[model samples]
Target chain A: MSRIQSVLQALKGQGRKALIPYITAGDPHPDRTVELMHTLVEAGADIIELGVPFSDPMADGPVIQLACERALEHGTSLRQVLEMVKTFRSRDDKTAIVLMGYLNPVEAMGYEAFSDAAKAAGVDGVLTVDLPPEEAEDVAPLFAERGLDPIFLLAPTTTEDRIRAISQHSSGYIYYVSLKGVTGSAQLDVDDVAEKVSRIHALTSVPVGVGFGIRNAETAAAVGRVSDGVIVGSVLVDTIAKNQDDIEALKSSLVNLLKPMREALDELAS
Target chain B: MSVKLTEEMLRALPDTRGHFGAYGGRFVSETLMDSLMQLETEYLKLRDNPEFQATFDKDLADYVGRPSPLYFAERLTRETGGAQIWLKREDLNHTGAHKVNNTIGQALLASFLGKKRVIAETGAGQHGVATATVCARLGLECHVFMGSEDVKRQSLNVYRMKLLGAEVHAVESGTKTLKDAMNEAMRDWVTNVDETFYIIGTVAGPHPYPMLVRDFQAVIGRETRRQSLEQAGRLPDALVACVGGGSNAIGLFYPFLTDESVAMYGVEAGGLGLSSGQHAAPLCAGRPGVLHGNRTYLMEDENGQIAGTHSVSAGLDYPGVGPEHSWLKDVGRAQYVSVTDDEALDGFRKLTRVEGIMPALESAHAVAYATKLAASMDKDQMVVINVSGRGDKDIHTIAQLDGIEI
Candidate 1:
């Protein structure tokens, strides 16, 4: 099994939910990313979703859009992001890392080259936000050949038939968008997402992790009750945005915010 | 002579999954797949229903002033010094552009779908004004997103859209142009999928949009076919139109795709030169990639990030073209070229002085090429150029260029 499967299965075996934190790879400063990745793992982050910035991030709301702008201001390329992964892998090899990005950059790098590079850099999964299953027919298999988990998203608006179709190509886990609209745009309704998650579980064996608008520990706990993993974005990126100048304070702020969520998920297991 | 194509090839494209050969599949986040599927189902049903199509037609005829004149440009023909040249006066449409043709159809569909609000994104502001005008007529709420740069550039059309009562939003992200406006509009549509309809300004975007907008705008080619025969005793030997997202060119070219005797030319904006990496001629100078929901020819860098596009005409200043245009280019069905900012400006001045027709800067690109094309043909042959819009909105840009504070 891949690193992603091994980690998620271990969490399920322990009856504890996984905590996934998303951060743009080159945000605040390019040199700070690998250290940040290590920091997140130290703060009880079960998995890391590293955003590779694209010029136009269609699925992102304003907060993450600004994050992209800041990341790109330093001339962060896809190759540089993979290098960061390599750097992070040098120190830690246990925590699963998923590269999250749009399609054009991957297409620019060519599918075979990207898959090879990503796998060599110790990437466990890839979640291309803009590449739905219909377009991933060729790409998913290429990624699979390199032993990388091809992750896909299922939204509340997705029909059951599409859910089944998307699940067939997905490995590792399916990122379930809890609300409509772009990322970080709406309030999450736990009951509704719970109902949808149950329906999805009825169809596919792939685990579902809930994300989009899981902005705080309360929301994360609420979502953890219904999902295999809880994803926290926008809020953490917002924190980084607020504390760009002070690296020590930024790491401290991330730890203080994320520790409670870890405690909350543990409390649920108890 | 054109390559022989089957009738099926002409009628059947974008397959069921929205692929045009290797291009034009729906590549979007999962949040939008269901909505796009819903739209496709509705459009498929509405396209064949006689009443729905009839309503669309009556609105086109009565509201949008269809059957716009196909005038013989005698002076322009004489100046070009070769073949007879004619102008398809899309400039005389209700909104002073061919953009209304598609907007009217989409607005009617919105009404049929029981949508209460309509949204659109624009660059030069013609499409926004066109969308706002149709929404005003149908009594639906209207919202238009335009990039801040375009808002400042096309202030006149911006005022026109506001006067028509649309809620105009100035998109301030990602190069601050048509692409950003489109990104914002998609956000709004996904946010309000149940109550609102997105009337795409061009034959771009996701699957059904390209097909839907093309069908609405096909009236231009249909009329040109009839008018060419009526006025010139034969089908025109050549067709020319400016291409941004390629709505107008596709509109005029779709019906004539089966006419193997006729040639088609699509003019793209060449801001400085292709070598300078400062132009917006995607089909002419760039490579194919997925952007704004479909796979198409796009101006992108080595890293696949969309590049900043420059053009004298705001409407042509976009990074990507319609997916079908990409397919057309690959199939050898259409020839795509570029005109410099200076050449387009000369075409704008020449048409205004000779024919008393002040063409939009976007359309002027076509005029610049059509004159050279006409000069290369025999006097007995005819060329039809789509004057896609009027120049009333561009007078200020021209005046500023001339250093006259008009």
Candidate 2:
């Protein structure tokens, strides 16, 4: 089975939800990034989403926005993020690693080259926030050939037709945004999200992971009850922003924050 | 009397990464990386050289006419029923705009960098004219990239640039507008990084650029500050200016950002209305992203694709803003708002009739905002507006709008 499938299967057997924490690679300090990645994995993160910081990130909220600014300040590029991933994979292989960001950095690196480099670095999947299903057609197959799942976001505003289109093109899993606005806005209706997930599940066999407003343990638990997985970004990004200067403190805080939701998912699964 | 720069102030200007408080830094492609580094090194060397400073200062005073008048607009004040209004007559500067202030500075810097040719991209053609003028004065080879649509609409500017011995290339790719022109210019710069100097028209773009442009344009505020003290015996209560890529606005706003009592207003172009989706109000409608170098607010789609923006004034039709302006907006140091195209047109006509001033459509946005703002405020307050450029080139456009051939 693929790395993503293995993670999903492990979750099913344990009757627990996967905790995915996202941190922009090379933020604050690149040297400590690999250590932070390992720390996050050990801290109960089932999957680690390493954000390749782009010069432009339209979908990100303020928390991730600041993180990107910090990362870009150090002259971090796609090459640096890929090298960091290579360093990360050298230590851990079982933890499913996904590279998440906009398409500019990848476009700047070219598709074939980026996919080849990513696979070499042990990246398991790719989730470009700006690459829609139609555009994904050009790059998705190349990634699949290299064993990298191309993830697509299914928004609340995404029509049924588009959802079907996204599902047909999507690999690994589907990312369902819970709100209308960008990542950090507050209003998230659990019932509305559950209904959207059910609608998506009806069309696709792949697991649906809901994100974009699942900030805390309660929301994660609530979303986890219906959805296959809960993807927490802004909150984890906020944590990294608050403790970026102190990596140890950031790791501990992230672990503590994810432990409750992970435990909550266990209770629901059982 | 001369104002000498103290060591502390000069050191405080450029930040650790060569920024002016989150405003400047080099964000570039690998092709021009070495060129930028060399330019940065040369710029640093020439900045402290006495010969360069003397030439720059002398040109500002004699040619561009330093210490531009701070005339109080008594009639406009009485009509608006607001504070006493004062105008910094940068529009009276040679080349008919404030763009000359930075063009002259960069032209000199280009020469110092041993660059044989100067290249620039223009939207409203103000910067093109300014750069061409300087290139003529300095005997440098000049090339300008303008959007094809702009070349057609702003034909007079194209002729003027050519007359100044500058080659004008009309870009037809993408939107065939300012942003596309900028991309084309960058591509050229990358191709000819060794022999050419890219003269950015606005306070946007990657690193030292935002800081460099602001420094060159700061002459407006510096002169305004001195002239205000001379004419009004004090600084004004508020300052108003138009923001395209925010060069003129930043030029006027930077000196006043630290002045708590001087309210700074940057008027963005609302082409039709905010709801019409035809505006260039980046701060209002855009989110923070990286484009054209430094991180700033930009108008982009969900997939982070840079969207083509709309503005009646070609100068204001950009997807992103200067990084410093973004930082200022975030800190609430200045207020950024929008004025619609109709309102700008009204202001343009009103200024022509009342003040005998044919203001550029870009500058009219500020005038429109100022007109509305003045009507609501108390008479005791004082306001200073940066009359950034002239509207002579816009006569044809204005005539076309009125269904009359110019």
Candidate 3:
């Protein structure tokens, strides 16, 4: 089984919900990424979604877009991001690591070479923000050969036909964008999310992880109640943006920032 | 060369999935799939509806001034001392360019789709102004996303859009130019899928857009085909048009696809020389990549990151071209070349002084290439160049270059 499947299964067996935290790999500073990965694990993250920064991240809002800009300013590339995953793997093997990015970088490296490098670097899964299932034909089999879960995004606008098509290709949990807008653009409506999550459950066996517009413990807990996982992104990246100059304070605040959401999710699970 | 394709065969392309032979596809986020699917359905329906065709036709003739004259350039031909040359007067459209043709068509579609608001992204501000004009005419709300850099460079066009009552949002992301403005527009479309219609300025973007924009703008080529036979008593030996996102070029080339006797050239913006790494000639120097929701030839770095493009013509300063152009280039139905900024400037001056016609900077690139092509051919051979837009918008840039404040 892929790391994502194993981790989610174990969490279900233990009757606890999963907390997935997203961070851009080279944000603030590349040197501090591995350390931050460890910090996120310590803060009760069951899975880590590491953003491989692209020059143009259209689906992302201003917060994550700025985060990508910061990460790219230091000349961080896809190969470097994979190397960071290898470093994090040396310290922690239990937490599932998914490399989240746009398709161009992988296309630049070619599928076979990227898959080999990703697997060698200990990446468990990948979620290309722009590569929907229709275009994932060439890349999907390569990831499967390398034992990498190819995650897909399902949105409020996705039809049942599309959901079925996506679920067939998606191996890791499907990311459910909770709102109609880009990341960090809208307020989460828990009721609507619950409705959509239930509809998605009817279509696929894949675990649904709700994200986009998910911020703070209250929102996370609300989302955690309906979905298998609550994936938080722009909020964490915003914290990193605020404390980029102070790495020590950045780590401390990230731990503090995630601790409440973890506690809130655990409370619901219990 | 690929198979010799007739116009029917060419139009049959983009298939159901919008693939123009591995060139165009709806490579977009899932948030947009359903919306694009809906748009595809609506477009496929209205694509053949008589009522839709009537409205589009009437608007093209009355509002946009159709059959923009195909004028013979006697002085240019004499000066070049080569082939007889003709100019397709797209520069004389209502909005001073051919951009209004597509916007008027899309605006009517927006009305039919019951969309209350329309959005567009522009590089030269011509498309933005064109879309804003249509929206103002139809009483629909309009929002135009433009690069902050372009906002500064083309402030007059920005004011024009505002005068048309459109909101101009200056995008500050990426290279802060045309490509970034497109990204912002795509994001807005994904967000406001239900009530907003994205009026893509060119024949790029995903599936229906490339095909739809081409269909609307094909009036240029359709008219040229008849006009060429009438004026020249035969098909022209060569056709030339500048290609930014390739709308004007494709529009002028589509009708001549089956007429294998006519040669075609698509001129790209060479900001400097090709070796200088500053030009925006993707078809000439770049490789194929997926961008702005379609697969096309794009100026990208080794890592697949879109490279910053440079061109004296703001409209041509984009990394990617329309997918159909990529297909046409691969199939060898059309030849894609480029002209440097200096050469295009020379073309601008030559046309103004010799022909008494002020061509847009983007159109000047075609004139530059056409001059060279015409000079190589016999005088009996006829060459037709699409003067895609007027030079009024480029006057400020020209003055700046000449060290004179406008």
Number of the top-ranking candidate, with DockQ as the measure: 1
* iRMS values for every prediction: 0.8, 16.1, 0.9
Candidate 3 ranges beyond 4 A from true positions = B1-3
Model 1 Cα lDDT, one tens digit per residue, B52-109? 9999889888988989999999989998999999999999999999999999989988
lDDT of 3 by residue, B1-60 (tens): 645878677767888889898789888888888878888899889989999999999998
Off by over 4 Å in 1: none
Clashes of 2: 4
- The TM-score, computed over Cα atoms with residue i paired to residue i, of candidate 3 is 0.99
TM-score of chain A, predicted model 2, versus the true chain A, to 2 decimals: 0.96
Residue lDDT tens for model 2, B1-406: 1123345654575564555554445544333444655666777788789999899999998999876788787777787888787788888999988999999999999888778889999998989999999999999999999999889888999999999999999986657788777867876775456688999999987667887899889988988887877877888888899988999999997776666677888999888887888889888788775567665787765434466688888888888888878777766777889999999999899888878888899888888888788877788778888889989988998899899986
The lDDT for every candidate, in the order shown, is 0.92, 0.80, 0.92
Residue pairs with clashing backbones, model 2: A55-B290, A130-B303, B25-B207, B26-B207
| Candidate 3 chain B minimal-lDDT segment of 10 residues | B2-11
| Candidate 3 lDDT tens digits, A217-236 | 99989999999999989989
lDDT of 2 by residue, A9-86 (tens): 788787777777788887767777788888778767778888887644545655676677688668677788889989
The full ranking of all candidates by lDDT, starting with the best, is 1, 3, 2
TM-score of chain B of each: 0.99, 0.95, 0.99
